[model samples]
Target chain A: MPAQTIVPVEANLINALEDRGLRKTSARSAVTTRIETASGAFTAEQLCRDLPEVGRATVYRTIRHLVDAGALCKLPMLDGAPKYSVARNEHHHHTICSRCGAVEEFRHSTVERVMRSLEKEIDGDIVGHRMEIFITCSNCLAESNRGGSSGR
Target chain B: MPAQTIVPVEANLINALEDRGLRKTSARSAVTTRIETASGAFTAEQLCRDLPEVGRATVYRTIRHLVDAGALCKLPMLDGAPKYSVARNEHHHHTICSRCGAVEEFRHSTVERVMRSLEKEIDGDIVGHRMEIFITCSNCLAESNRGGSSGR
Candidate 1:
């Protein structure tokens, strides 16, 4: 099983700030703390609301900073606002459970191989890619199999 | 090779408008013409700028309506505004050339098979997914092979 664990987002923030030759102020710390403990995908608006002490500009800037630093990932939704999540792995994709809002990190060799083969067919150099698989998670599947009602 | 072609955006708009019990107004027709003639991908702001006679609200609303109707697809960019493109095919993913901004629609069985297998591993039912591959198009590859500079 590929390791499915959250990265040390605070450490990533500190490292990113250091790389940019910046200091970690109290506001940054507060935002990092909130993000570290976030349950699943969140939004900048939610962060701004939760971190009232931090300036809205600071919140947005900090999120953008971390995202640029590869510390955060955005989950693109088809019909709604995009959501943000901590980068779980250096080279992994997401399997998001639509039913329970659970996001799982996964890495598979088969997928990577398929991506590499595109170089030949497209006759181009493959630079980067993004994939998001939406599903009903395992737990949700089990619950539905048992015909139990979910609070969600 | 799978069919790599643009969908009939105007027909799609007409059908969508009909489904909503709406008529094909001149404004809608103008927007459709612009979209149909768009090279690869476009933005709402660009469309609004090009069609000054169309209300900004109408431009935004029509784009949303057609997007919901599966006439247009949004190319989610990593560092900039998401670009809009005509949906080229049904049940196909995109390969965007970073060099020339060319978008190619492709459907590969291996990719689909891998996605389906996720059902067993994730213990969930797969609902939907989106994949966008960034690459250099075949033409760009040839140009680069000849050591020629691209205008882009």
Candidate 2:
């Protein structure tokens, strides 16, 4: 019988990670995988749901590390918890349901164009800006019909 | 000796507020003033610190009501509470401090222009966008040199 030693996984990704002083533990990889596979913005609790063995502190650390390293971005919700999304080259924003608290991704660029025109219009020494669109999603609409949320 | 009944102070702001179905209460005006004077983003708790008489529940209710009416907007933060800001006619973004958590506004149109051009290049229909530029504030930088935040 032969005993097996630990074989390092995620060779390439871990190498890039090590260059930035990040640990290549299973928890890190699990958190990364979950975030990568997420359909949209995620709360820490949501990330922890998939990464069962990961600690809350570890999840917070991973989020901070990824955000600092430009691997992810944080979206703050009005309800207190912040949501994290994978950073990408494409510019995007979210449309959140106000009534039932649902979040969805909507692709549109008029916001970008308007921001650019405004910068030219003002001599205020243009910098950067943010855009968030709020919408009542279809699921929330259904929920509203079922007497779940008021003021829809 | 005759004493007169105190006439309810009906301020013009309250009169205008009445149009929206909200009562003309002192607490409501104070909350509105705080939101109006806030330089950047602020949480309900932070707003309460300035006006001790305003209850947390009142702050929450007022903020929610204003946001529902489109008179205000919520800025997503990286941590802690979700900050609220008054809605404006044009679009803009914020840069927040990593240390003291102070926020500074940025408005470089080049970034905005590039986003617009990029959207067109990809054949994507443009709608709206939020741009946030994260940066360390000077006060936090100074304090960090001396020591660190007592606690944020």
Candidate 3:
């Protein structure tokens, strides 16, 4: 199994803030610690709901700062608001379960090869890409097969 | 050059509406026609702006109906609102220029093969996928090469 790693967000966020001449407020510290400990992608609203002590505006502001400081990457979610994940060194894509809202990170050599080929074929300077595969997890499939009602 | 095909929206929308038992209103007809004739993906706000005669609510409602009926597909746009395009029979993906707002459609057998392989690796029933490549188009590249300021 691929090792699922948590980003060193607290240190990074503190360094980023100091480098940008921003103050190390308690709110920023709290938000960064929460984000650092989060296992998967999340939305700003989710952070607010989970961390009731953190103000909504503070969560939004800290999120923006983290994104701008390259500590987080915003991902587009279908049929809902966008989500944010820790910025990692390696390039990877996500396979999301439509039924259970589970996201699995994946990387493949073929994907990189195809992207390079497309860059040449289209004669464009490729900057970035987003690939999301929507799937029904095996658990969800099993439940549905057993005549259980499936929910999105 | 690859053929840029226009989906026959009029016939498809009419059939889709009838199958769903939805009314064939003039507003729906007008929006469908506009979308069919459109050369690229567009947002609902753009439709309302362009077709001032069409009420905003009507445009939104028609868009919802068409999407539910499978006559249109919603595409996620980075840094902007989601866009809608006419649904076609064939599976294809898009490459968009971040600088110039240009879009190019592409298809490859390798992408399908990769998705199928991942379905087993992740042990999920893959249902759908979204792939969007962000690029700097040749025109934008050329302009930037010439030391011209590029706009988003």
Candidate 4:
């Protein structure tokens, strides 16, 4: 990766928010930074706990702002909570662990093409799609073998 | 699409749930029917009103069972509710109208290929991606010209 290119969208994102009349407070910035540097899907509660200084209400507001601004994307989890991830222009879908919620990003051109062909066969014209691949992560697989109870 | 095909599944599904030890109430049957016949994503609340006698908690529990049993696929809405559709072995994405929440399912084979090629080209190794195409449905487009909250 180039040292300065994509140097994290935080600074530019903050200015963008300020222009929209949303304050660039620490609470918002912390939330933004956490999202910008994050690897996979996360919830607002997860962000709040990571950045303890951010208030509960502020965390909610920041997440709302991020999604509205296209800075983050929201996905439906089987567990029913709305999870957010940093938005990237490049397209892909996740392979998630059902037990622990660990996520892996995947890119397979063949699968993508096959999916598209399927869509064309189903609907005359294609508009869009959401591809989330679920897998039991290695750690979660281990835990399941241990007979753990919390699906939490 | 065949009536006979659906009739047996309806019978077996109820039996299966009972085999798994869930309550066999009308609410459960209605929820199962809706998901079995649904052409697109939906929420538990949509079924709540449809099956008036079904308690809200039961509606939720049934949806949970459907997902757990792989009878339905959960899709996320931008607003935070988990919407479910009939389960399938294949993968595709969705195109949603921002205002009216009308969703149409579609696919793009080249988009994934392009994302993968981009991932490699940029050395980003794309992990996952989500794409939602937003446009006015034909009715919504017509309604908007008359200035009704065509979607909102």
How many steric overlaps are in each model, in order?
0, 21, 0, 9
- TM-score between candidate 2 chain A and the true chain A: 0.69
Each prediction's DockQ?
0.58, 0.21, 0.65, 0.19
Q: Model 4, which residues run further than 4 Å from truth? A: A1-12, A19-21, A34-41, A104-119, A122-125, A136-152, B1-12, B19-23, B30-41, B88-152
Tens-digit lDDT string for candidate 3 (B71-90): 77777765678888776756
Decide which is better by DockQ, 1 or 2: 1
CAPRI grade of model 3 = medium
Over B7-79, each residue of candidate 2 has an lDDT whose tens digit, in order, gives: 3443333333566898878999898877666677787789889889999898888877777766666666655
Candidate 1 chain A: worst 10 consecutive residues by lDDT?
A1-10
- Of models 2 and 3, which has the larger lDDT? 3
lDDT of 2 by residue, A1-152 (tens): 44465445433333445669866889887777777665767888888777778998998887777777766666776566777766554456665555545555444556566665654444333344445545555665565678765644
State TM-scores per candidate. 0.81, 0.59, 0.83, 0.63
Model 1, residue B65: what's the lDDT?
81
Model 4 residue B133 CA deviation in Å: 7.8
- Per-residue lDDT tens digits of candidate 3, residues A16-109? 7667788988888888878878777798899999889889998998888887887777777757888888776458888778887777778887
Chain B TM-score of every predicted model: 0.81, 0.66, 0.77, 0.64
Model no. 2, DockQ: 0.21
Give lDDT tens digits, candidate 1, residues B1-152. 55666545456656666577667899888888788776778778889999999999999988888887787887766545577887767888898888877887788877899887766776578898888898877788888778766535
Ranking by lDDT: 3, 1, 4, 2
- Sorted on TM-score, best first, the list reads 3, 1, 4, 2
Q: Residue B147's C-alpha lDDT in candidate 3?
A: 75
Best by TM-score: 3
